[model samples]
Target: MDDSELQAIRKARMAELQKQQGGASGGAQAGGSAGNASNDQQQSVEDLLIRLVRSGQIQKKVSEQELISLLEQLSQQESKANKTKIVDNSTICELTFPTSVLKVKMNRKRLLVILEEQIYIYSLKNMELLHVLPVRSNPRGVCGVCQSPLHPFLAYPGNNPGEVIIFNTDSLEPVTVISAHKSDLAIVSFNPPAGKGSKDDRLLLATASEKGTLIRVFDAVTAQRLYEFRRGSMPTTIFSINFEPTTNKYLIVSSATETVHMFKLGEPAKARLRPSNSETEAPAASANKYFTSVLKMLEPQRDYTCLRIPTNGNTGDTSSGNGKTKNLGSANHINREFKSAAAFCKDMVVVVTSEGYLYQFKFRSPEFKDGELVQQYSLKSM
Candidate 1:
């Protein structure tokens, strides 16, 4: 067909498509007048392009392929600009402490700031110091605070290595003092109410010693031991420990040894293999031994300095290594160590590394095999 005939056919086809779209969006047009206006504007733009082509004002007839390519280029440029954008974080108000601030915990009502040997509790609205409580000299900055609406409490490592002193946030009085471990306390934290089953009413406390060989859980109110899980014989720093928020069925422990340990809680003794079972079935149970097997150890694609456990379902890979057949365990291929991590959803986690690279991992099981890495962000320049 000649140019005029081809242009006429194309114009007719475009008009037909626009009519179909308008009919399909009639319900939306009724619900939103702005949407109808937008559609009208888009149709006008298309008509303008056809008119320009007919008038010979535009020398070139831009094909659909060329338009698509231009759009893709513009999208890529916009994405690049977004990725390189810098964020500014300037100081709003400053609160001076007698010593360096170790950690700060806040809720809607109060702000608890931890110093070298004291905790200053201030009103969130007024910033007035309501109470100042002295704690053991914490040089390593080992302390944790939680102020959940269901169960609120403050915890710190005691002067003695094994002791953990619990205090009431409202009364500023001692709730209970318990000997948690033989070695120095590394960290102490109160697990928020895991919103699952009948355990929603109970708050659990988790503690790790300075040696990092063992992690113990206790009933926060009764001060009764619930579960004890061993990390390893070797002394390592327990970077962070988090309980699954929904079921409390598992606990994730991240350590300096470049490992993440997942432990199944509330399992029967038989489920957790005994020494006798391991001795009798050495070859069969070797892969699932008591201490080593109970701890489902996971090494991330990169060394993770911190991690978060999902609450509702099993959401990590169970494969052996980074989904590669060759050079599976090679040290040269692993990613950089992660500095911190938090749960983004039931199946995804957001991780930040020491070098300021952020990664999101989505998996299907606790073993975290065959997982998908969604996006990686760098904030080093900012």
Candidate 2:
């Protein structure tokens, strides 16, 4: 080859090498950011995200081994500033009572509490019982009275006709028996946010039974049935049902299958009225259209091995319009985002295994799109 042709080929090879080095350096920085997402300021995250622009794909073309190499590169760029690690082999909590605790939640103040035979409302601040309330449930974890974000009163499915016995927290008595469903209801919930209902009277919930694979919604105060959606033909044991409190229009329900379904609460009310001037909503909605969910900060679905939604607020409609069923992001995607860490939830998404172990995650997500998953921790760890 002539001198000119050889010189051109050398220049092309040099450019390709430069491109590879840049990619390597970029990957290292991204790995570091993920390793220490919690530490990086908002400004740094913005810069990193710009560099690692991803090509959205239905399936992963990158292999795990190759991905790991890239991830290591990214990790190198990050400071690894949070070098302090907890070495305790023991868990954060020791099992005191051997009760097979099925339900556990935190209050608005982020107090870690568990509800088994009775309500254990303990204060996380000083590790003291703030107050104890009496609760009643059947073998399959069915009780009308439960702690939910929407309603102060706890309601669980009764033994008959999808019935629910509502209990007043202050009185600690079954004040009402509402036939919330036709079948034996497994759980009850509000439509999500408090007071988002028909005439502000209905509460939404889910009913699971060995009899069929279906979920039904009901009006808690009015005893009126709303809608019944056929979950599937499989043994309709609904494991988890979560209603977003602020939107009051989404339900994240997990069934016997490995997948979780997210349905948006549709605006079914056909009236126009002024919103109440509540501290959080009235002024905010009136001024701007940026109302966030109270439960948005809590983890959605982390421990798939065992997970449960604090069943309350079923007044709204869960209509991820068009009846589309899309698989939520994979576990790795969830871990990448939640790796940084967010605030804690006192009582929100919870689960309990057969070994009498209780699992909890404070569900938190920046966006409120249905089916978008945000896990608190790795399922493998639990």
Candidate 3:
């Protein structure tokens, strides 16, 4: 179209929008919004302060002390809110399977599985059957399978001929298709730290591929890529990206190498994105450090065990040693830790090993200081 024609089209659209704003209180398809835009409320005081700093609105000489004070007050408020945050390790439900190699899908209501390319949705209320949907592809290299934390979509990151298909739970259909950057898939884990407190944040799915370690964060609702977190020296494998239980950050991904990594979903604790100074530099800003020595290691004797059972009690000699089955034997039967899935579900971590055994345990962290994952829990016998 010509310039005059384009201008006329824009004018007509603007007039229509004005008419809608003047008359309507709520549009049928507009989610939480009206045409008038009166609901676009003022920003919070803390948010305003951030905007001022970000937009360079805060004058350089308008008393640095005063701006510092305002920022400190905002920090205090945020800390108070985060202090009340509870660690959600509550056991929701469990799913039993005959075969050890099974995929899992879960929400507040039920657990779904894809075994032998047949989808089985299980009810969480009674642990009964729901329905089954048959998959077309031959189940070959399917490793990581779980529902997205943000939406009602299921993801399986594996050797699907270089592309991973995202399926929906309610309809049992392929909703959106995503892939590794020009290669076969490896491991995929949803970033758990997003969408806190009923917020609709896009689900961040990190995928490993044969090419390298690629991070693909996507909108769970639309199934579109948002940001990509890239790393140096290519990860050993995609399965290397593991997550840890933390309110601060969602992922604790590591390679086969000695170093482990931590990532944040929001504004980092001590980082700000600087304006681009060079073309060669990356766009997004990040604050990550390397683990530097013997301090990187955990105390093997005291930690790494699921739980410490009290073998020697106050009155051990009085009780009969034969009748009461010893707890120490069960605890020490396996010196090695469970080689389960890098990611875990509620109250239970599914660990897999070279030997065929699916072990379940409550992954609890009594503490996390510096960089150690001091997890302790009781083992569940099948």
Q: TM-score of each candidate?
A: 0.56, 0.41, 0.41
Instruction: Write the residue-wise lDDT of candidate 1 on 1-382 in tens digits.
Output: 4546644643454354333322111100011011001111123333443454355542333332222211221111111010010111322244555465555555446566666676766555554556666666875556556656744577776656777766666655556655688888877766655664644556778888879888887777656566777666788666566665567665666555434555656643334444543346776456545457445321111111222222122234322332121212322213443233232235544333333343445534465432344444443433
- Mind sharing the TM-score for model 1? 0.56
Which residue ranges in model 2 land beyond 4 Å of their true spot? Answer: 1-101, 104-137, 144-151, 159-161, 195-203, 267-321, 324-382
lDDT of each: 0.49, 0.37, 0.37
Which regions in candidate 1 have their CA more than 4 angstroms from the true location?
1-93, 196-199, 267-344, 363-382
Instruction: Report the number of the highest-lDDT candidate.
Output: 1
Lowest summed lDDT window (length 10), candidate 3: 77-86
- Please list all clashing residue pairs in model 1, or write none if there are none: 316-364, 316-365, 317-367, 317-368, 317-369
RMSD of each: 25.4, 26.4, 21.7
Q: Write down the lDDT that model 1 would get.
A: 0.49
Count of residue pairs whose backbone atoms collide, per candidate: 5, 45, 4
> In model 2, what is the error at residue 362, expressed in angstroms?
18
Q: Candidate 3's error at 153, in angstroms?
A: 2.0
Better of 1 and 2 by TM-score: 1
